[model samples]
Target: MIINKILNVDDYYYDVFMSISESLTGFSVNELQSTGLADIYYKHILGQIEAATFIEFLNTSKTILENSYSQDQLNNAINAEIIADPGMQDMANNIITMWYLGTWEGAYVNDLSYKEGLVWNIMHAHPPGAKQPGFKSWGVKPVNSNS
Candidate 1:
């Protein structure tokens, strides 16, 4: 109930989830948002974990972002607080997994999530079965062919 209210308060908290995710996943916000699964993963994680812990995770991430002066500081702070803290670490790892693998709790969230996995983007390849390459297009893919 409160998260619904807080989420509506701004551009999805100007997407605090995105900021936390960028710091955690080593992916820029643009890259994360580009996957089209950011919001879905956010809500998905909420469903997988306790809401209050996730919220505290968000706040801790926000504080780290606000207080840190450089990238190293940000990384250190995240590792120390968000990743190392017992309450947040599992959720942190799960978020990273969701971003990279498009799955939550070892299961794919949906076809869209699968197709849009960061793994595909990072590996510069699509899921083999995601789209028929048309037998003719099967040669070594052009470097830019991942999309």
Candidate 2:
């Protein structure tokens, strides 16, 4: 439960990850000997930080970036666009989300802003220094996907 409390701030995302990890690896607070949910939460957070760093590195090279319907949809869109697949539009949105709410830097610096959790609102938040992406879809999915 200690891990749960620590992750409380981000329960919407991390809880699901915990459930799945527990199911797959059979790791729990008792088994891991974490002090509390915070320990568990932070451990996962560290992993996510590493993954996000890798993602930021990959995204920095893009000429354009788009927004995400939700944070989870981000990776799929990016992969789709990289291959020049039809999903490029969605990927563009994900890049835009990272640029604004996330992190991205490369050959050319582009800043972006989006209202939290919406594709179109992100464009509206665009700071003066950032380039605006032109994705048509503006629908926002709820932050938590689990019931």
Candidate 3:
């Protein structure tokens, strides 16, 4: 609750993150939210992303979205090299990585938990060391997808 009060992160931030997530991962907001990815991403951003850069990214992204940019345009804007500062770029990259990997790779890597990682969700495979696939699972195709 303290973080919620201190961050004052509203639905707008989550909406912006969802839009960016959809653009980056080609996944629907509903799908991401259903897996609790949205909350995970938001918390990661709050804890790791620089506040000023995050706010700027959100504002710029919201403007681009409101302008009715095509998916390609959205992607281009989100991935644009407009962020000149290294710190901002790191923040941006961290957000993108979190969506794909489902874990934040920050200064303190140990803070990330394999159980909650997103890589397994994307790979449709369990975390390598933490959870083993059931017996003989390796012999057959992965249940989620071939890839």
Candidate 4:
């Protein structure tokens, strides 16, 4: 059938993502949501790795062009490195965050250098049992040491 090729491509894409996510996080895509970052080693580690990997990838790509490496070779190398890097997996999670946040109000990549730490601090610096400042106040978290 003419549609078979497209259907197979869709299935292949889903299978690839599912297998990779499961290997990295030990949770299928469906299972990872609603789980606290702290409770999941793979998810937590992946996030950090992803950020660092992307930063490295940008530097590497720049270096390759500066050094006059063949564009095709450089592209292949970079692709391989990203696939092997756990950090890229973590970056995927954050990319999802960026998507969820929409356009970021015209903020550029440069803004991230200044803004990431500030946002991180504000999100995590709340007092014990405190509701996040901008988020809805759900009174008193139940007794969970991690919370």
Candidate 5:
């Protein structure tokens, strides 16, 4: 159930991978792509999962991406199908795990994954050892923090 794959993978499914990730993670394609980790995550998924299984998953979700109107629409569409099957929903969660924590099944993919984890993006903070702030960065209010 645990495996790995990632990018530099410019084949048929790579685009779908990114698109689905955007829908699932609530991050724009540009934001996800800018991390330079898309290829790595894509490759990781391919390695961990059977080719046919992974391909079928992507194909099943591709229409959701094409017809997406907003977050709710995409979420509803994905949930209506994936959540109907617990196994499919698990795979969807695993994909989210790969993006948010940069690991699949609690295993670290690479150092870059840590630095570029979507959790930091969501928090509007740099990852642990990334984007080092200059002196006194902490003295000021957090950029995205309400406090």
Candidate 6:
């Protein structure tokens, strides 16, 4: 996408997003992309975020990724005080939250379908209204007995 153009990184836009997602959430690039979080994040950036701010965030992230040699290094870079601009920081936070929660900030909860949300992944629980635990599964000594 245009994110690649904005970041001017060697990797594709989705790959760049995957790297950021892995650094932010400790999840693999494949996991984030496969779960549709990457696409969601791209859409959010294009549709909701301010153009100049998003470009600034992408450029900052690109620089950080270019300097880091490993995943830990990337994580360190992200945690560093690289983004001093408040607007860029806010955009960065929104991207990080999208990776973790699978929803953009300010989205109404009711507007999201159960499976589309990533809270179930974080909570290690099935999505409500779909694949619910077996009968009495919650009452077992270990709530996760089915697993």
Could you tell me every candidate's TM-score relative to the true structure?
0.84, 0.21, 0.68, 0.25, 0.83, 0.70
Q: Would you list the rank order by lDDT, best first?
A: 5, 1, 3, 6, 4, 2
lDDT of candidate 4 over 1-147, digit per residue (tens): 422422343433323333333333334455433322212323233334443443354344344334545646645554565445676534444433432221122332233222332233434443333324455545656344376
All models: lDDT?
Answer: 0.78, 0.35, 0.63, 0.38, 0.80, 0.63
Off by over 4 Å in 4: 1-9, 32-139
- Model 1 over residues 1-45: C-alpha lDDT tens digits? 766754452544447789888877889999898888877777677
Ranking by TM-score: 1, 5, 6, 3, 4, 2
C-alpha lDDT of residue 118 in model 1: 82
Name the TM-score of candidate 2.
0.21
In terms of lDDT, the poorest run of 10 residues in model 3 is 106-115
Query: Which RMSD values do the candidates have, in order?
Result: 3.5, 19.9, 4.2, 14.1, 4.1, 4.5
Tens-digit lDDT string for candidate 5 (1-147): 222232346654788888888878888889999888988788887778777787778877887777878878888889887767787788889989888888898997898888888898778788756667678887988876667
Cand. 2 Cα-lDDT: 0.35
Clashing pairs in 1: none
Q: Tell me the RMSD of model 1 versus the true structure.
A: 3.5
Clash numbers, per candidate: 0, 13, 1, 5, 13, 0
Q: Cα lDDT for residue 127, model 5?
A: 72
Candidate 2: tens digits of C-alpha lDDT, residues 1-147: 543443454643344333322322234524322313323333433444454542333343232123545435544444544435534333333334332243222221212122221223323443333444346534543344354
> Pick by TM-score: which candidate is best?
1
Deviation in angstroms for 28 in model 3? 2.0
Q: So what's the TM-score on candidate 1?
A: 0.84
lDDT of 1 at 45: 71
Tell me which of candidates 1 and 2 scores higher on lDDT: 1
lDDT of 5: 0.80
CA lDDT, candidate 1, residue 39: 72
